[model samples]
Target: MPEETQAEQVEPQPQEPETAPEADGRTDPWSDPEAARREIEKLRREAAGHRTKVRELEPLAAKAKELEDAQKSEAERLTEQLAAERERAAAATRSAVAAKVEALAAKTFADPEDAAGALDLTAYVDESGVIDRDRIQADLAALLERKPHWGRPDDGPRRPAPDRTQGSSGNGNRTPSDPANDFANWFKHSLDQAR
Candidate 1:
């Protein structure tokens, strides 16, 4: 075995790193802890910078969209406005139709819920959103004829007799005879019951 010089040992060490298994041609920071930390810090700073740029651009983007809208041709703007008006008008029409339907249903159905579940309200409105009052009245009349029970149970309070004073004789204990001379008989009857 030969004794090696320090300079010779150091000389081969510099070349070994190039052919070392741990070495690769790439420059990514994963191979070095300090380099990875610096790279992570740099990426964080770049992300913060991009975030600030996005924040700065936010108002400009809104303004650009506004300007684009402002610069639209009159026909285009008018078309959009007309479309919005049409949508609002349609909503108004639907609301009006629903109100009318509810009012009509309240008059016709004994139960308001029955009108909601049993009837197809669209049948009362034409394509132009005009309600057909005649048709609704006729249909309700027809429904009452088909299912007579569906109508409001007669208009007054339900009771066994109309006037409470009418057909009721005096307290049911005595016969339907004059009571002027019946005190003794009534007393004896009461005593008998008490026994």
Candidate 2:
């Protein structure tokens, strides 16, 4: 409850100045404009060296781009060449298939009479040897125009029909033609359902 002394209430003050280190009368190196100019000059020299390096590498960068472009062009050329080769191979395969078809047709129509009277021979055959519907139709038209009398069903001319008589199995005795013989070896409709 006694009164507080003024000296006890007062705080101690620091001896250091509130400003920078220049209070000691010594100049800071960064404060000199001429020294700062020298530092800036050094930085500019380093930047100039970097600029020189960039200038020197410019041709290399351009060459790398050129190489990349060349590689791309070569890849495109190879892709085109591969596609063309595949097309050629496909064409060759088609040609081989056509040849095989021609061989089969020749085997089917061995006789001239069979070629003329049986199925017109040209109805399902084409010049390309393939059984294309449009090509076969054209060939059939040509054959009909060439042989008008051959396709005439109304012509009463007695042409000898081919010997389609079925032989007996094991019996040596020959029997007469059966009344139902016409339906025995009839051509099925399943043979004409192709596209």
Candidate 3:
């Protein structure tokens, strides 16, 4: 065996491990489950308290808003009313145009709804809200020309009303619709019943 040198023969001395920096004395939630649970509970309580506060303040906030609206200037109130009236007027104009379109389209188109939907109608109403009937007619003509099938056909689905279907099975009791036949059927049925 080779002679052991003094350097090699010295045993390894165990040194103390370096201490980690201080952790602000707080428990690591991952390491302490109870601490994590307590923290969650505290947060929940705080959230509940905030919610209760909000509930108490809601009525006051609504009253404040109501007061603010009530204190508005007469001009501001009139402006609001004017805006609402203008909206209604626009809606009425559109409705009037739609009704006219529906009635007119029904004359040429098999499905008035389809024709009404297909037409670009915004231009039919002028800035003054007067409907331009001439423009609407022109547009309808152009649409019918572009899509010929949208127009009603002379021989399409307008067949004569179907006769009410009579039961064809030759077996069931036939109730006579005519009063003269009813008396004859009653006698015949009574005889058959006796048999």
Candidate 4:
């Protein structure tokens, strides 16, 4: 047990060289070319297996993408169809309202445009496509009451006054004053005399 300096006190032992791990974990195969070749072949087999799996799934992936695209196109077509249907419905409704307004005005007044201008057509039509006739009549009556001049006379278009001179006989004698002794009756009498 003599005292020794730090460098001298330490003794170096024979060291084993470190090598890379093998597949079996028991031996270092780097030194043997045959073992390295076997490992490379094993890795190549594994890579081939992975490639085979990817090949098997390729068709399925393509089919899934195709189905997704089909569904998207179908949805877009349905959306366009819905929009077209809505436009058609709106146009039909507008035409129906205009026809109804024209018919109502013609039935109630002399001037259809003036009658249409006085009432709200939307109010008289319900969602169920039923027209409120009573309400329309009431509204029309109220309108006529408010503007009394809007009421059309029950008598139709006026006719010109009859020409009394045309009914006189050519013999310088005036026709009878009786209501039935008009030009028509006198013409019938002259025709009977000729027969």
Q: Rate the local accuracy (lDDT) of all candidates.
A: 0.67, 0.56, 0.76, 0.72
Best by TM-score: 3
Predictions ranked by TM-score, top down? Answer: 3, 4, 2, 1
For each candidate, give its TM-score against the true structure.
Answer: 0.33, 0.38, 0.48, 0.47
On a 0 to 1 TM-score scale, where does candidate 1 land against the true structure?
Answer: 0.33
Off by over 4 Å in 3: 1-72, 156-160, 165-176, 179-195
- Write candidate 1's Cα lDDT for 109-146 as tens digits: 68755544555666677787788877866776777788
Clash totals for all models, in order?
0, 0, 0, 0
lDDT of 2 by residue, 41-70 (tens): 677679889999999999999999999999
Q: Tell me the lDDT of model 4 at 47.
A: 86
Each model's RMSD to truth, in Å? 17.0, 22.2, 21.6, 15.3
Kindly report which residue stretches of model 4 are placed more than 4 angstroms away from their true locations once superposed: 1-48, 113-123, 138-195
Alpha carbon lDDT of residue 57, candidate 3?
A: 100
What tens-digit string does per-residue lDDT give for candidate 4 at 111-190? 76676687777787788877777776777778777876666667877898988667647767765476666777989999
Residues 1-195, candidate 3: write the lDDT tens digits.
122254246455544444454589654553344444467667767988999999999999999988887777666989999999989987888788888888888888888877778876677998877888888888888899999999988765777876544565475665437887888999999999999
Q: In model 1, where do residues sit more than 4 Å from their true spots?
A: 1-80, 116-118, 126-129, 142-150, 156-195
